[model samples]
Target chain A: MKGMTIIVQTITRLVKIFILLYGLYLTLTGHLTPGGGFAGGVVIACLYILLTLAYGRQWALRRFPRRLAGSLDSVGGFIFLIVACLGFGFGGMFFVNFLERFFPGRPFALLSAGTIPLNNIAICLKVAASLFLVFIVMAGARLLEKKDRTYDYKQEEEE
Target chain B: MIQLLPLFVAIPLGAAFLTALAAFKARRLADVGSALATGALLVLAVITIGRQGVYPVGGFLAPLGITLVLDGFSVLLLLIVNGIGFLATLYSISYMERYTSKYKYFTLFLLMIGGMNGVVITGDVFNLFVFLEIASIASYALVAFGGEHEELEASFKYLVLGSVGSGFILLAIALVYGATGQLNMAGIAMALAGTDKHLLIAFASVLFLAGFSVKAALVPFHPWLPDAHPSAPAPISAMLSGVLIKALGVYALARIIFNVLGATPLFGMIVMGLGVLSMTVGVILAVGQWDFKRLLAYHSISQMGYVVLGIGLGMFILASGGDSVVAGTALLGGILHLANHAAFKSLLFFCAGSVEFRTGTRMLKELGGIQEKMPVTRLTCTVASLSIAGIPPLNGFWSKLIIVIATIQAAFTYPGLLVLTAVTVLVSFVTLVSFLKVLRYVFLGALPDAFRKIKESPFFMGVTIVSLALLCAGMGLLLVPAARGAILDPAIEALKQGLGYGSRVLAGM
Candidate 1:
């Protein structure tokens, strides 16, 4: 499929960075704010999805390959686990906010809430990557189906 | 000890993700990583056997943050889940070689394990639902891993039904939350204590029964099992049939009915009635199947009935103010059978997998004389078949015997229970007959032309099947006095305490 209209593409190019930055802000400030990893992650995922729609699959694949997104998904989940396991090294229980002991920042701040903000960031990474992977795979399946149908049509014509 | 609780869920989650990340670079990372992760889990399960404690996640206390409980009941389930999970992972190292993308397979496998562990350890009802969804989704994907027409069909069926079950569970949890304003199990039970018979609680209870019965593959709700179990890779079939249903379905149902909702004689009768239905109908249907894995799947439903019957009987006795000894004996039989089935049923599935791996078919009529070619698989299959058939000295025999004796003793008091006792024995006899058909058709007949050159399964597969077979042989020893004291008694005591669990957990915290 070709790209969308030039106007749509131009607007997406201009607005995509702000959308991504807002998603970043929401994820980083999740512990105190209403929007957390799941909501903000969807927002971030929307940016890429918008890019894919505006520029087509080929353009998106060139910038952010499916393999990289898949790898990032796994790495994000591992980071979350590592943060939880680090609690043991800090002489506390599993999932304990060990960072609170070292840095008891003021409440309602972005850096506060111990390990929670870090966990939010990790989840945002995973959710964003996984959602994109799902989208790509589904789109790829549609393309394959179309190819199969056209190939069958050619074979029938030859027959 | 309490701190070790979260490791059950955390270890596998970490390993799965790391494998997913690193396996792209090093192809062998998935195999080594999952094996090590499950290995650690088995050791952790062993070390925490008799210890009981509560961990409040994030130090937010029980009523607010999630709590992980390591009671005797949870410990028993942990052993079964991790022990079988380790073997399944080990077998997959070799068995999954034929399938592509080993890393993705291992990632999903460990996630399923992590989810099961989370289900058993979590003390909050809503947390249980979350873990249940995680495990269910993973299993659904694993079932369709091969992407064959049959596999996809079965997986879609399972996924739809499983989602409906989850919906019922969520609705029930919402009802309970609305009624009690509590999410922690102990707090819910405390709030539910002595509350007069209310329709809301009854509605929640019925929803729990329907939801969990579907998960457990009980009769009338068991259409998906026969298809889903046979379509997956063999090791996966073993895992699904072995511990997943029991852990997700039976354990959750029993815990809620007995501890949270406070078991009553009426509920006991409903459970027992369902048990008898599955027991009679499952074997009856299993008797006609020629497909190896499909037959085994039907038998899973039958065996689960035995577990539910024994536990249900115990619940009836306890609620009706009958003899505590009899109640203890009955529940012990039920719980013991659960563990015993995990070993033998998984062994049975592994044996079927081995045959399929070498010969490329699971249809009983299409294969013959496998015993001569794959002695290890044949021997393990025989042992597992005998164990399931309740032959003497095998693990299945001891548990079935106890359940039978308990039922007969209950008959002396009620006389109506005599029907259940007779059904138990009759079911055992029919189980033997059906397995005899399997034996004759798959192993004892003359060799087929197509299968003559097939060899035995790989080294790790043989090791896994043999180890599980040995467990099947020796599991009866768990009934010995010393072992019983350490393992079975504590779990039974926890259930018998009923609503008292609320105060004990609260006091412990």
Candidate 2:
């Protein structure tokens, strides 16, 4: 049973990594393609959801951890803001695409599209962590309900 | 100065997501983290008001790519969104303890804030819709956070009405897009400058107005608000009344009408009619309410009516080619009232939460004589109530006074001005009467037998309430010339520019 669980966990982890990579791919190509920050972020969150479901809550918690997600959310928002601020600093007004002048690299390249790629990544991190946190709180409440059994008793009493 | 514009949305969004993630393990950390995030945003909003300029997004020239404009109008909204958001977060820290899932609450709270910020900052019309939905969706879910019968019912009502409103807005956007072939607001303005499709524009404008009016909970579309606002948790109640309606509904409506569509006299008349209906009806309904939070919710509709009336009058004057000074005053009073309302309303909701926390009920008759037990709460509640009633020395009075003055100056016939003014005064009286019922039943009467062991709320909650009460007093200072010029004038100017917004954004780029 232990070996089977281990194999299942490994497979789920591999699948999650694949999803994460796919989300990144979409985010990077967001400006040129239909998939953008919100779509990519939801995809990333789906991977996290899969991991949590496949390998129990404890396993998911141990790997991703709350602190890491929190930091990543903050970092993503900050990067998006910084990218906008950089435009202002270049005397291009707030949120102007300053990278066009400074980095002026090819227009449709992976690293091109000015601040679009950075914004995509930032939005991805934000949405993923936000949705994951929502799931955690909701699922945690359910888990607590299973252990306590008091809610069930109370419901019965009320009924 | 311009560099900090993006921080308004970024800080709150970042903080909300971070708080949500952190709360999973160190559950206690969510409160402080969310508070710090909103606090930072509030400060940034203040700084933004001082830095007057447009900030385009992605360095792309205007009319082609998306832009984020931070002008007087946007800054005014930023102050309201971030300021109330911070206080609401503070209140939530203690008030949300009863709920089983606190982290989820904070996460949704932040997403709502991020969405509102995005709505205020984005220069692209399509982007505004996206952000508006983000905020609206989160709010829909938040209303049902309690997961009770009433909460579920209220959430469904809000969702249906809100979805209909959103549909109207989307249809309006499609119409505008088809007409102008541009997604950017400024670009659309430029395209429509010499157009002769008055009937189509009018139709689209009506759709936008109806949609936004629903979101704002205007009298005609206000059935959902009383149920929705009272159903949410207290902090969220504060958010919905204090900021959400104004940002998502009133602000968006005003921006599109004045800046994009060039506010016509017909639009102004519709706005004023809605305002009068809401003010009269909301107050009358509020007076009969037994639920404390529900009463406050009804009053939100009435107070927002006052805001719409003032702004509508300004639009009428401007569209008629009347004196610019009087128009400016009207606009200033309307916008200032928006800010003032945020402070007082949130404070009122916080007080209601404190009462619920201590007395375990929001029903007026069920609550009695807990003032001695919760002195700080009583004081704050009194201050907030007095402010809302437009008592002198409080913030609400000055803004109302300005509106009344501007109405008279705008050459409103004596009877018309007198009647509107009378309605305003009557509404204030009704507000005071309802609050007095609250005071008498909840604070002055004999303490209920079941509440003997009740205690004051936690320190954070008290701190949040008291600070808001203080703002109730301090915000009156905006009437002073220096303060008015520094904070309020620019916002009025931004609106007065009308379709000039297109040129300004283009110029910045």
Candidate 3:
């Protein structure tokens, strides 16, 4: 219930940053490539899940606490909404590509698609936080506690 | 004004997160922010009356990009969903103080409201499914918010059945996409219009009907509703029964059948059949229930039957080339009943919630004589009870009368339809009897010694219930010529247009 062996912890410490970096890369380049916010976010969340498995709840919570994760999720959702609503202030309707004329960057570049890359970033933040929250909520319980697994049923009898 | 259409969905969604973040610091922000958000949406919906337009999301033209349409049907539903939503949020201001995690509750509540708005306005069928899931998932979580054994069990049942329904809906969407190669509603209608009635389309239609039946809690797919509705927090119970079922289930069904697939005589008959079954069966089961909320939940099923029957009769008449005036009358009755039910049903649930809040019990057998203590609740509950029982001059009466008259008129052309007239009356009478039981058991009779100290519900709760009660008493004005022209008639006309909706939408684009 504490954690894994030192070897697994050492390996996770080395690989976690790279995995997070790769997820960010995928999200930033999503407009031009296949792996977008959702896929990239899941990949980023996997890094934390790996940390939890290797180093236990104490170490993982130290890095990404519950409140931080919750805030990140809300912030991401709000940012996405603001970006969508931003188009309304311009000449075009809601969610319009008002940035297209200003940016007008080269095609297929990282910043070529107006508002898409920003949206992808927002979604990446949201999806990553949400996946981590789900894992934490599930694993906060004693995963190996056979008693905890049957906890819900026992409560039913009490009712 | 058309440009503001997307704000209907975006505002609440944005506020959901804002509340989530802000409430972590202040806590009170959640209450103020949610009420303001829903109140803004209500104002927006009112402004939309008698006006119609479409806004393509991201400025992408229809058939290529997602569009938000604000036609009469969408407007009607927006009013019901947002109007009740605002009241529910206000009621929750006082009601939710007893419950922990108030911020989280408001967050999910706003999300549900946003999702329902998105479902109403979206012009694409696939987009409809996505918003439906959003609303459904939010509801599933809210149902289990209490985390009690009963709440968890009810939530699990709802989640499982709801997921199956969503799966069916997704499969049907795939079939429709494969058949028509169109994701937008107008495009799909146009494609389906030219093609013959193929087995693939019929299969998809069947899937849609079955799926929406689950969402609407129709007879065969209704097992989850009774358990889920009563177990949630009372404001949520009001939301679920009042607007969620109508928005996600019946409205979606009507849009698909009338606008996209175009209702044929056979489909109309099948819809009418389902309506009759729910009406008879829902009341029959409801009559035997002692739980106050459960009885109301069953009555939800039964009242939905009236709405569906009215619309279905109109659809049948339209498809069968019967009198156009009669068809319009039937559709009017159905759509009007839909609005009336939203006000009165939520009011009833609010009353139940207030009673439960004060006395800590919803068991009809144990409670009594609280009417002397909570006069506001007693008065509002009586108004709602009268409305639902189809008392004249109240809103429910006018709609029920229109439906009955339509059924009798249709009987001249089709004799079997006469039976539905009698059935509708019988169902109304049975409903009156059920409410009479609720009144006698909960508000009347000797006062239990345990409840003598209870007070009237808090101010916010009383304001909500009273406003809704006033709406219940005054909503018959919607039938007046001036109001009907602006509100009910437009929606009825939209449904009556049927497959022609495709061309109109295309023209708007």
Candidate 4:
């Protein structure tokens, strides 16, 4: 797929960093605010989608490959499940808030709620990677279909 | 045993992702990891047969924190889900070779297992819905795994209808919460006990029935199962018909209605009506089908009707203040038939899959006697067929007999029940006739020239299916009082308590 116009590309290049930063901000401060991992993850995915739109598919894929995104998706899920299983170590319960129970992060701070922040971060990685992957795969299919149609039209004209 | 309740969900989920991550390097890891995970679950379910516990997740008490209940009811369901899950995984090792992306298949399979486990063990209403979606979404993906035009179309139909069902369930949960201010099943039971929100409760009850009926594929809501079950791979077909429908649809509805809302005559009547309709309609549809998998799928609907009928009869009896013994008898029949159906139906699907695996076709018209070549499959398929037809000395006959006897016992109290007994017998006869057709066409006819070169399925698939056939034969031994007290009775007791379940759970905690 080809890149967009120079004007659009320039704006996306300028705006991408800020959007990524905002996504991180949302994820890290999820416990203190309304936005959490899922919200932040979507925002981050949007930034990559913007990059894909502004630059070409090849450029975007070179920066963040499908293999890397897929692995990251699994990694995020592992982190989440491991966090839940870790609760079994601190307490017999499957998802007990063991950190808050013993370590007791300060209230109204970034580390409060013990495992909730970690969970949010894990969820953020998962959502962002999965969403980006979904976008690219779907776009690839659409592009393939379009190519097939054009090739068929060329054949018809030749006939 | 109670403390480890979460592992039922955890183990399968962890294996799913683990399979995905590792299979990128070693393509075979998906097979071993998934089988080990489901095997672990089956072992866990086995050891916890008679045990019951209320686990408060995050160490929060009930009515406040999410609870996982491992009562007799859920334990039985856990056994069926993970037990069949282990076998399905084993079967898929050889069976899934025709499909690419083996890891993706295992991943979705494990996710479906985890989701079904969660649905069974959860005591919270909203949590049930979440797990229901998890299982449903995984299944929808698996149905379309083939990526063919027909597969995709069937999957789309399944998805749209499934989402509508989920919407109704969510709306009902909201209504119940609004009325009782409780999301926990027991808490709802307690809060709703004395309340006069009759209309609200009635409306919510109807919504739950409609939603769960759709999931269970009760007649009016059953259009998707025929398409979705057949289009998927054979192992997946077994799972969908064998345990998935029972866990997500019948078991979920049974839990919510009898335990949370308590049994009422009207609820009983409506459920039984749906059951009877599904029975007749499903078999009637099956009688005309030529596709092997499609025929079994229709039989699944019909057999599920038998289960629902028994349970509904129990609910009706208890609600109307009838004899306790009759209610227990009816319930025993229903729940036992569920387990029996799980074994035989999955075995039947496996046999059909084996036929397709060897012959490269599933249509009855395209299949004929290869029985001499595929002796093990022919034998196991015959066993499963007889068991499903309610022939003597097998599990199916015992449960059907119990249901018929219970109906007769109840008929003295309400003469209308005899009519039900007649219908039950008639449906059983129809089931036999259809199986006879399957046997006559596929196994007894002259060997088709096309299948002369065909052979028995792989050793693993044969072993997996034979184990299920063994279960179909030996499950009748569960009727012995000592064994019954351990597994089946507790499940029956769990439902028998009805609204009293609230106090029992809270006190147990």
Candidate 5:
């Protein structure tokens, strides 16, 4: 049983890493294509879910605790707000493209989409972390379902 | 103003997504994170109230790419949505302790808030639909959070009707897009300025009215609300009844009718008729409910009707080239009521949650006398109830007075004023009766055998209830001239702009 668990954990970890990388790629390239923060965030969250399913809730919790995810969410939101505030401070309206001056007329490159790419990245991190947290917290509590002891564990075991 | 515009949507959206992810590891993290995020947003909204501008997504101009507008209307809605969202989060911190999955609750709650904020700020019509769906879907899921049979039934009913409403909205959008070949509200308004499609426009207006009215849970379409609202967790019920219908239904409807489509007398009459029907029916239904939350849910629809009637009355006066001041006053009263309702209604729901938390039941008949046990909750509930009943010196009374005055000022005659007055009085009376039933059963009578040890809710919940109760008392200050200029005037001006919104957007670009 231990060996089997190890194999599953190893496989799921690889898969989760792969998914995260893919989500990152999508978020980074969101400006040049249709995929953006929302899609990327969901993808990243799915990676976390995969890990939880394979390695157990405790393992998942240890690696990516709630506090870290929450902090990351705050940071992402702050980044988006700071970007908007920067625009306001730069003598333009809120969320104005202040970076445009530095990258004048740059067309369709990875970094050329101005604030769109940055916003997508911020949104991706926020959504992915928040969603994974929700799933973990919900799934973890299922462990307590049998604690009520309405039915004897021994009786169930005999069956 | 333009730069800060996206923050309205981005902050909440980011917070929601993060809350979902964070809930995976630590359970309590999402709650705290969401509360802080919403608190920041509330402050930001307060700051942005008088500021006006548009932010174009990417580097594209308004007509080419999406834009977020921060006008009076958007800012006013931002304050209500984020303000209520913050309080709900704070309340949930304590109230949700009994629920197994606190993270999921906070995540969905934040998502709904994000969706509402997005709906209010987005300048694109299609974007509005998308955000509305996001908010609506989250709310539907939250309503069924308990996964009980009753909750499932209520959620399923709400989902089916809500999808139909969304379909109607989409169809209306498709028609508008076909008519003007533009999805941005301002751009479409510009396109329609010289068009000879008055009949088509009118048809689309009806479609919009139908769609938004259903979303608002107006009289004829409000069957799902009483079931759904009562089934959700308490904080969620508060959020839903307090702000969800208004944001997706009334706010969007008013924005489209008054600003984008340019309000017509026919449209005004239609809105007024729906308002009158909903007001009469909701209160009548509410008077008979034995469930505490269900009673409040009915009153939500009834109160929303008053808001709609006030706005509709204002539009009627404006369309007929009557007194613009009276029309403006009517609009102001309606919008003020919208904000006031968010405060008092959410407060009522929170108090109900506290009562249930202590007593382990929400059935009015099962509860008997606990006011002495939970003084804070009883006090807050009384304040909220009085506010909703439009008692003197409370927020509700001022807004109701404004609506009554505006109705008479519009020369709707004694009959029209009499009908408005009578319905207003009836709804308030019904509200009082239902709450009195609540006070008598849950607080005033002998303490039930089962609830002898009931305690006040946690500190966070107490803080939230107290804050909202204070707001219920202070909200009348919005009637003051400076506050009106700073907050209410911008929203009214935004509506009065009518199709001129198109010109403003183009000019800003």
Candidate 6:
């Protein structure tokens, strides 16, 4: 639970914001460039993972709790679905990209792909939150498993 | 109405998200949410019957854009998935109260439903694989949801085998895409019809058979079923048995072979051979099992065999240019058996769950004289058992009879098929023996002293069991000409249309 050395912690603190900014940049420019929601989300998740590795579990949980991560993950998925359903509602079919038809943002612009960029943001939120949650849960389970093994060893020694 | 095709996938995905978010504090929200979502799907599935059209996702036309095709075949599968899904969710509302993370369960349930809906409805080959993964992953998570040693063990076995199956499918799809230069099913069919890629197509066909037989739990690849089916919670057992295998396994396999790949005699023989092997081996294994759910699990394999037999027979006849009427009869028998098994087998699992719920034991040796104690479960279980055993009046009898008759009629074309007819009858008889043992041991025998205080399952659970029983009894009416014309015949027609489905869908666009 005591995490890594002070140097790692200090570097993570200084470098974390830039990593987050880079992820956001990728997500924002996804439609125009190569990267999209998933790549950006993984990068953002790596930022949190780096922080968790640098700081202790307690420090990380205090800042970004598991419950919040789970809730946010659901919210992200819901938002993505809402975007699709909105297309269905406004247009006659599912995923009609009504935003593009009506607004038709300038080609090669940031908002050019109508619902695509919005969908990327939602996917970004989802992939980041869920990945972080998965890491935390697996980490917690490993800790419990270690405890269980030691407890079994002690019981055997006594018996 | 066709515009709503995407809703089949959307409703459950959205419900899963909302349930995960909102059902944390109010426990009933998960229950109500799952119920309402599946109910809506069931209603949609009913409305979808006898209607055929194509929905282009995001306004993209076929051969390029992803399409959701609604055909007779897809409609039948839609009805099965949503109908059984609704009942399973209802059963879970009570049964899953025992599990602490009810919301998580509901969320996984909805995701699985969405994935299945997507698999059946998608017109693109890759889309089917994606949906198949979604459903498979969710089922894997649910299988391990209990976090017990046995549950984890069963789930791991299932995961490894299921993943292998998926790998084969993905590789086959890659080959298909490479050979045909098409991702859409219609496009592939058209390409296939025009070209002579026999080596490539044949390799993909074998891979499809291997992969889908695993999904369908046909004989050679069914090692995961007995463990995986019984290890999950009971309602989940029903879903895996009654719906999942059929949708992801049988339905997907049949669609590819009949409609997309265009069935061949070699493929037909292999499929029928798998079906026959599964039927014999599954029942022989079941005849000896003392564990109640495990017995039912084995029976799922056997009954799936009957379905495969029917479809395989039809495919063979069609490929060999046998009598069209005989082929149609075989197809009808196979497809109707699929629906019939959905009702009876699911109900049987619920009955097992109920027995487990009250008595806290699934060992047939431990249960006795529960009939007086839980009359509804007892009655429903009896009905389901009779249906599964091919008794005179129930749904199972009608489908099995049709299959046997079709085989007999088909025997004139190929005398070898008479053996298939004989085996089908023999399997039905053995099934009766197995269920008879169940009735004798569990419901009709002396009551154990420890079980004197036991009562029936809770209201929701009993309601599911009874409603399913009603379905089992009345599903025979589906064989009637009028009902068959509306519900069953269209599905057969879809399959009968075969490679024409490609042109039909493209024309719609």
Which candidate should be chosen as best, given lDDT against the real structure?
A: 6
lDDT of 5 at B217: 95
List model 3 lDDT by residue over B344-462, tens digit each: 99999999999999999999998999999999999999999999999988999999999999999999999999999999999999999999999999999999999989999999999
CA-based DockQ, model 4: 0.50
lDDT of 5 by residue, B1-509 (tens): 45556766667766665665556688767877887888998888878877888777754678878888778888899889988988998888988888887877877787798899999988899999999999999999999998766887899899999999999999999988888788998988898875664777788888899889889999888888999999999999999989999999999999988778777777787898888888889888888889999988999999999999999988887876777888898898899999999999999999989888878899988987888889999999899988998998999999988987887776553245566766767777777877777778777887878888878888999999999999999999998999989999988988877788889977873
lDDT for each candidate structure: 0.90, 0.84, 0.91, 0.91, 0.84, 0.92
TM-scores for the candidates:
0.96, 0.83, 0.97, 0.96, 0.81, 0.97
Q: What would the DockQ be for model 2?
A: 0.28
By DockQ, is 1 or 4 better? 4
**Cα lDDT tens digits for candidate 6, B24-125:** 999999999899999999999999988999999999999999999999989999999999999999999899977888999999999999999999999999
Residue A16 lDDT in model 3?
A: 83
Candidate 3: fnat, from 0 to 1? 0.91
* TM-score of the first chain alone, every candidate: 0.86, 0.77, 0.85, 0.86, 0.79, 0.86
DockQ of each: 0.50, 0.28, 0.70, 0.50, 0.16, 0.58
Give candidate 5 misplaced runs (Cα > 4 Å).
A1-159, B194-197, B412-418
Binned by DockQ into CAPRI classes (incorrect, acceptable, medium, high), candidate 2 is acceptable
Evaluation by DockQ, superior candidate among 2 and 5: 2
What's the CA RMSD for each of the models?
3.2, 5.5, 2.7, 3.3, 6.0, 3.1
Off by over 4 Å in 2: A1-159, B194-197, B411-417
* CAPRI accuracy category, model 3: medium
Ranked by DockQ, the better of candidates 5 and 6 is 6
Write down the worst ten-residue block by lDDT for model 6 chain B.
Answer: B189-198
Per-residue lDDT for B328 in model 5? 94
> Where does model 1 sit among the CAPRI classes?
medium
Candidate 1 chain A, poorest ten consecutive residues by summed lDDT = A150-159
- Sort the predicted structures by DockQ, highest score first: 3, 6, 4, 1, 2, 5
